[model samples]
Target: MGQLVRGVWTADADFPRDADGRFDRAASQFRDMHVEPVAGRYHLYVSLACPWAHRTLVARALLGLEHAIDVSIVEPVWQDNGWQFSDRYPDRLHGARYLWELYVRARADFTGRVTVPVLWDRERDTIVNNESAEILRLLHTAFAPLARTPRDLVPEPHRADIDAINARVYEAVNNGVYKCGFAGTQAAYDEAEAALFAALDELDATLAGRTWLVGDALTEADIRLFPTLVRFDAVYNIHFKCSRKRLVDYPNLLSHTVRMYRLPGVADTVDFDHIKRHYYLCHRSLNPRGIIPVTGQGAYLRLA
Candidate 1:
C-alpha cells in the first residue's frame, strides 16, 4: 500500500489502518469537473487491476465515449515506486516513464497518493479528476452531447435514489471487502465481514425478481457495484477473506453480474489476468507467497 504526499510518491509500510486495526481508506485528492464536453481532450489513466478504476472504464464504454476520450492502461503489477510505464506499456498520450511523472507534470509540487482512474485534461495539462465516482459522473452526463448512446446512467429523477443506494453499497460492499482484507485484527475482520455479508444478503433478497439495482433500467449504481461483485468470488473470497459466501451462491447477484457483463462494450473492460495479479501480488501483506489461484473457473463463468 502506497500513496502520494504533496505530489511526492510515498511507499506505505502497510495498509492504512486505524487504532483498532480497521482498514481506513484515504480520500481521493484530485477532484475537478469538465464544464463542457470536449472530444479528444480528455484522457483516462487506469489500471485494469483496480476495481475503482474499472468503474470508470465501464462508464466510458456504456456512454460510448470510446472515440471521444482516449485511455491509457497501466501494467498490472505495482512495484515499490508505484505505477510505472514501459515501452510495452507506454503512456499512449505522453511517453512518460511513470504515472508519477504525469502527476508531477500536472502539479510539480503536488503531494498526494497517486491512484488510477485519472481523467487528464490535456488542454490544461492537468488532471480533471482522479476520483472514480466523479469521473464516472462526468462520463455519464458532462459528455452526453458527444456520447454514442442516448441512455443516461444517472437520470435526474433517479439521482436521489441512486445516491442513497450508492452510499450504502459503497460503504458495506464496495469498500467492505477491503476493510475485511486489510483488517489487521480479528475484531476488525469480523466487523467488516458481518457488514459485507449483511449487505449482500439484503441485496440478494431485494433483487429476487428485479433485473437492476434501481427498478427496471440500469443506472450508475449498478456500474458502481459491478466491479466489486464480479471480483468477489474470484479474488476477494480467498485473497481478501470475504468468504462468508461466494457471489455465485447468490442467485440474483450472480444473474445481475452476468446481465451487466453481457452488456455491449462492458466485457471488454474486464481483465481477469490484471485483476488476479494486482490483488495477489501487489498486496504482499495479504499474500506473502504471492501465489495466484488457478481455479478451473475462467474469469467469467456462468453462474450455475
Candidate 2:
C-alpha cells in the first residue's frame, strides 16, 4: 500500500487508489535491460508467493539461464515495512536484509512501490527492470547464446499475435483477479469479477483445439497466463471471490494449464506453499484472522 516518493521510500499506506475504492496498481519505476548476457552478473530478486515473480522464475528455467542468472527468494510473509530477507531465508547473493534495502542501495532516494521479479545488474549495482513482463522477454531472448536449452518462447513472426493475446490475458485475467480481491467497493469487485470470467470463457473457447495461446509453440503469452491460472482455483476461487466458475469446469482451459505445467522445468517454478501462505497471511486487511485453509485439493492436483 506504500510507495517511494521522489526516490525516498515512504510508507504511503494508501497511495495506490483514486478516492473511488477501486484498486489501481502502480507502474513499475525501473525499466531498462542488459543487452549482454554475462554469467553471474545479474541477480533475480523474487518471491515464490508472487505470481508476477513466478513468471520470471519459470522463464529463467525454461530458457536454461539458471546458471547465468542467480536468484534470491524472499520469505513469503510480508512485514509492515514490506518484503524482507532473513537468516532463515538466507540471501544467496549480496546478503541484503530487505528487498527495499536493494532499492535504496540502487538509488539512495528511490521512490515507488518496491515490487518483485526485480532483475538486478551486479556490474552496475542497479535494477535492470522490475516489471515481470519485461523480465520474461529479457530472459527469453537476451541470454540466448548462453541458454542450456535453446528455444524461442516468443518468435519473431508470432510477436504481434503474442502481444495481442498477452494484453487481453493480462488485463482481464492476470491482473483482474487482483482487482477483484483488492477491490474496496462492491462496484469495483463486481466489474472485476464479471470481466474475469468473461475472459476465461473466451480463452476456454479459443483454446478448444489449439495446444498453446499464440501458436503450436509455447510463447511468453502462455508463461504470463500460467501463473495466474495455477493460482486461480487454489486461492482466487474462494478467497478472492472469483468463483463465477472454477477452472476445472472448463475442459479446454484445464487441459491447457496442465500442458504448461507438464512442460519440463516449469513445474519446479511453482510453490503452492508460498503462494497460499502469502495471500492468506500477508493481506491482513482481507484475512484479519490470518488463517490458512486446508481445503479441497483444488485444480493443483489436476496439474500433477
In the order shown, the candidates' Cα RMSDs to the true structure are 1.6, 1.7
Q: Which candidate is the best by TM-score?
A: 1
lDDT (Cα) of model 2: 0.84
lDDT of 2 by residue, 89-137 (tens): 8667778887888888888888778889899987888888999998888
Q: What lDDT is reached at residue 17 by model 1?
A: 86
Clashes of 1: 9
Let me know the TM-score candidate 1 reaches against the reference structure: 0.96
Number of the predicted model whose lDDT against the real structure is largest: 1
Candidate models: Cα lDDT each: 0.87, 0.84
lDDT string for model 1 (219-244, tens) is 98999999998888779999999987
User: How do all models score by TM-score?
Assistant: 0.96, 0.95
Could you give me the TM-score of model 2 versus the true structure?
Answer: 0.95
